[model samples]
Target: MKKIFCFLLILSLSAFGFYPSVSSASEKSQQEVKEAKQYVQKHVPILKNEFKKLSRSSSLEDIESLIEKHFKEYPAPQSLKSNKISVFDAFPEKQHKYEKFSGKSLNLNNLLNDIKTSSTGDVFTFESKDNTVKVLLGEFGDINILEQKSISNPSVSKAKTTKATGIQRQTGIGYGTYGTKLYTLWCEGNFSYNGKTVKVISKDGDYHKHPSGSILTLDPRGLGKERDASIGKYKYKEVFSRLRVEGVLGFKWGEWIYKARTVETYIGSTVDGNIYGGLKSYK
Candidate 1:
C-alpha cells in the first residue's frame, strides 16, 4: 500500500513536469573550460616560487618585507587596498586558537599541509608569537598579511540593541537559445536583508517580446536572519553585504539551465566603543 501511494505521488509530479531533463546547456563551453584549466596550470609555478620564499623567511620582519616588496612589484587589487579587510577576518578558519605553536617559533609547515588537503574556496590563518603577525591564505592561492593593530576589538554596550537592517542586490549575465535563434539573458534586483522583500531593478537583453517559455529566479545567501549576540564584554553587530550573480538559459519546452557565482565584499567598521559592523563569519 505504501509503495502504491509513493508511486502515485511520483506519477502526479511527472505529469505536472516538475522535473526537467539535464542537457549540455552550461554557460561555459568546452574550449572555455580547457582555457581555464590551462591558466591554473601556468599559475601554479609562480605560486610555488612565492611559497618557497615565504617558507624560508627567518623572522616576521622578513615576511613583512617580502610581502611589501611583492606588493610594490605587483599591486594588490583595488578592493583589498582600499578596504584593508583582513583575509583572516573576512572568512572563517578551521582552527580557532593557534595553540599548537603558541609560544614556539613560527612554522608554516602546518599551514602548508592544511592548504594541500583543503579544497578551493577554503580559508586558513596562521599567526606568529603573541598573535602579533598573521598570515591568511586562501586555497585558491590568494594570500594576505595582517598585523595585530589592524584587528578590531570592540567593547560591549549596556544599552539594548535592535536587529541589523540592510539592502542587497544581485546581477546575472549569460546566453541561451530559443529554437535556432540565440539570445543573451540578464537580470538584476534589489532585496531586503531577509530576501523576502524584492524589487526587480532590470531584466533587459532578451530579444523575444513574448517567448514561448522563460523563467528567472534569485537565490540569496547569508541574508535575512536574527544573528545578533553579545559576548562577555563585547557587543557585536554583524552584517553580510555582498552581491551574488546567477544566469539562466531557457528552452522552448519550459526547461531552464542555470549558472551561478558569488562576488563577496565585506566592509566593516567600529564606532563609539561598539562594533557597528564586522566580518560575515565572525560571531
Candidate 2:
C-alpha cells in the first residue's frame, strides 16, 4: 500500500506540472498593453502642445526658432547623458561598397558598411548649444567624419517654395548613447498637412555637427507613397545660424506626406569636420 501511494503522488505532481499556464500569460499581456497606452498618452501630449506653438511661426527663421525653443527634448538616451549624441550609436555596418559624389550628395550604402566595420559597444558623449556640437569619442571603435557640407541660407530649388511660406517645418531627431542604442524625437504638429495624414514606417539616420551647426542624417529608401508625393526642390538652410541638416527639403509639396528612414552606421570620420552623412525624408 505504501508503494501504491507513492506512485499516485508522483502521478499527481506530474499532471499539475503539465497544466497550461494560459491564465498567467494573459494577465501579463494585459498589463503590458495598459502600460504602453499610458506611455503614449503621456508623451504624445507634449508634441501636440509644441506643435500648437509652432503654428504661429511666420518665417523659416521664425519657424526654426520656434522649433529650437520648443524642441528641447534631446534625442540622446539618459545612459549616455548627452543632449544630441550617445556613445553606442551604430550605423549599418557593412552593406554598400561604392563611392558616389555630386556637388553635394551622399552615398549611404558605403557609409552604413563603414559603421558596421567600426564601432564597438562603447558609449560616447555629445553636447550642442547655439549652433555648435561638441562630441567626445571615448575609448572604443575608430571614428571617421567625412564630406560635411554647411550652408547659411543655402537655398535649393526644393525648399524655395516652402521657405516662402514662413512656416516652421517639423523634423525628427535621433541620437545614441552607451546603454541605449538610439533616441528619437518628433513634434506633433510637425506632421499633418492640407487635410492629409500619415505615420512613420521606420527611420535610418545619424547625428552629426557641421561647420555652421548641428546636423542629423537620414536614409530615404522604402518611404511610402504618401511621403513620396511631397517631394520638392529645397536648399540648405540654417534657421538661426545654429542648426544644420543635409538633404532636400520641401519634399512634401503636393498631396503626399514625408516619412524618413535610417539605419545604423559607423563611429568615425574620414575627413575632419565632416562627421557623417545619409538621406532625409518625412511622412
Candidate 3:
C-alpha cells in the first residue's frame, strides 16, 4: 500500500506540471554545465591575451579603443543582456576583493588564476563591489555585470584658502552622481590680484562607476578678469575677481546609464577668496 501511494502521488504531481521528470531536468542541467565549462576552457587563453594587450596601452584613448574592440569581438552572452559586464583598463590585482552574487567577497584575479587549472564541471561565480554586481561562469559562462548605482545628486562643499606672493589659492570639492552613486572631484585654482588672472593649477577627480574607469581633465590656461572661456563641453565664467567653472562630465560607451547620462561639476571662487564646488547630472 505504501508503494502504491507513492506512485500515485508522483503521477498527480506530474499531471499538474508541478514535478518535471527528474531525470530529464538533471540531464539538461548537466549538459548546460558541460557547455559552460567548454566555453571557458576555449576562451580563457584569448581573454588572457586581451588583458596583456590592455596592460601595454599607454594612453586612455588607446585603452578605450582596445576595450571597444574587445567588446565587439566578445560580446556578452544573451543570458546577460540586461546586466553590465565589468571591463577594466588593465587586469586587476589579486588583492582586490569583489562581491559575489551570493553576497560574499571574492578575489577576481585569484579566480582567474584558478581558471588556468580549472577541471571539467568546475563553476566560478563572482561579483564586483558595486552594489552586488555579479559575474557568473556557468550556463554558457554567463557574466552579469551591473553598475554601481548608489550616488546621490551633485553638490558642492567649501574648502580652505591661502595666500602667498600676492597670489591666492583655493580648493573646492565637487560631488558627481550617477543613478544613486556618488563620486568626488577636487579642483585648485590660483589667482593673482595684481593681474586679476585665474589659472587652474591642479585638478583631480574620480567617479563610482565600477570597472568603467573615471578620468578628470583641466585646462591650465590663464584667463583675465571678467573673461569667459570654453573647453570641450565645459565652460568657465568669470565675474569681477570671482570665477566659476562648470561643465558636463564626459563618459564613453559602457561607462554610463541612459537615465542620468550627463554628469556635471562646477568649481568657483567667492568674492571673499573662498572656494565652493558642486556637481549635477541629466540625460
Candidate 4:
C-alpha cells in the first residue's frame, strides 16, 4: 500500500502540466476536476467519504483543513514536522561526503558523478536556499528534484578574494535575531569575479542588484554545521549561512526534503537570458 501511495503521489505531481485554454473549456475543466476527484474516491476508498464531505462544504478554510486531513489520515505511519531542527539544535556527525561548487545546472548523473562519492545511500546537499535537502544515491528514486534543473539559488555567497576574516555584517531591522542586520546577499542575484560571473542563484536573477563588475574571491569548501536555537529561545526564523544536509525524504506536506534524481544550479546564461526580469525555467 505504501509503495502504491508513493507511485500515485509521483504520478499526480508529474501530471501537473499544461491545460487547454479555459476560455473555451471552462465546463470541461470543471468536469475533469470532478472526475479526477471521483477517480480518487473510486480507487482509494479511505478518501471516498472525505471527498463527499468536502464537496458539500464551500468554505476555503474547511476545504484546506480537509485536504490536510486527507493525507494525515492515510494509513501509512509517517514522521511529522520536527518542533526544532533538533531537541538541542545539534546536528549529527557527518556521514556523507560533501562538496560545494559554482557551476552550470547539469543533469543528475553529471551532478552525482561530480560529487565523486561512490558510497551507497549517499545524498547531495546543494546549500543554495532551495537545493539543500539530502537525497539518497539510489539507482532508482522517487523525488522530482533530481530531474529538475536550477532548483537552488545561491542563498549566501562569500567574496572571492576576501582580504578579511569573515563575511560582512550590518545591524538592520530585518529577519534573524531582533535588530541583527547583516550585509549578506540572498539567493536573488549573480556573483562575479574578475570578468566571469562567479555566483548564480536559482531564480529572481533580474530584479535585484547586479554589479557592473568587481573582483571576488570565491572559496570551495564543504559547509560546517550550524544549529537552530531551541523553541521560544529562537526569536526569528533560523538560517544557516552554509550547511551539508543528511536526511531522508518524507511523504507529508510539511516534509521539506523531496526526492528526485535531478536538481539545478544557477546558470549565468539563465541570468543573461532574462528579458526585463521575466526569467523562466522550463523544466
The numbered model that scores best in lDDT is 1
* Candidate 4 stretches greater than 4 Å from native: 1-70, 78-106, 109-186, 190-243, 248-267, 270-283
TM-score of each: 0.26, 0.21, 0.26, 0.20
Write one digit per residue (lDDT tens) for candidate 2, span 158-275.
6333212111212222221111212222111111111132222222222333222122233223211112222244212111101122322111101111122222221111111111
Backbone clashes counted, model 3: 7
Off by over 4 Å in 3: 1-33, 53-57, 82-283
lDDT per model, in order? 0.25, 0.21, 0.25, 0.21
lDDT of 3 at 63: 32
Model 3 residue 166 lDDT score: 19
Q: Per-residue lDDT for 5-120 in model 3, tens only?
A: 00000000000000112233333344433433344445545544544544331332343354346545764332122111111101122112211122222122223235454321
- Segments in model 1 whose C-alpha atoms lie over 4 Å from true places: 1-39, 55-117, 121-236, 246-258, 261-283
lDDT of prediction 3: 0.25
For 1-283, candidate 1 gives per-residue lDDT tens digits of: 0000000000000011111222233532445334433433344345445646564323446654654454445433332222222122222241232112222322222332354442422222333422233343322233333222212222222442321222211111121110111111111111122112212221111112112123323334434222234354543323333323333421111011113333221221111221121111110
Please estimate how well model 4 matches the true structure, expressed as its whole-model Cα lDDT.
0.21
lDDT: worst 10-residue window of model 2: 1-10
Q: Identify the candidate with maximal TM-score.
A: 1
lDDT of 2 at 220: 26
Tens-place lDDT digits, model 4, residues 1-283: 0000000011011111111112333323344434333433333344333444443323323433543465444422111111112101111121111111112222233233443444222333323321222222221111222211233232222654411111211100000000111111221223222222222211231111112101111121111112222245322111112211111321110011212212112222211122011011111
TM-score of model 3 relative to the true fold? 0.26
* lDDT, model 1: 0.25
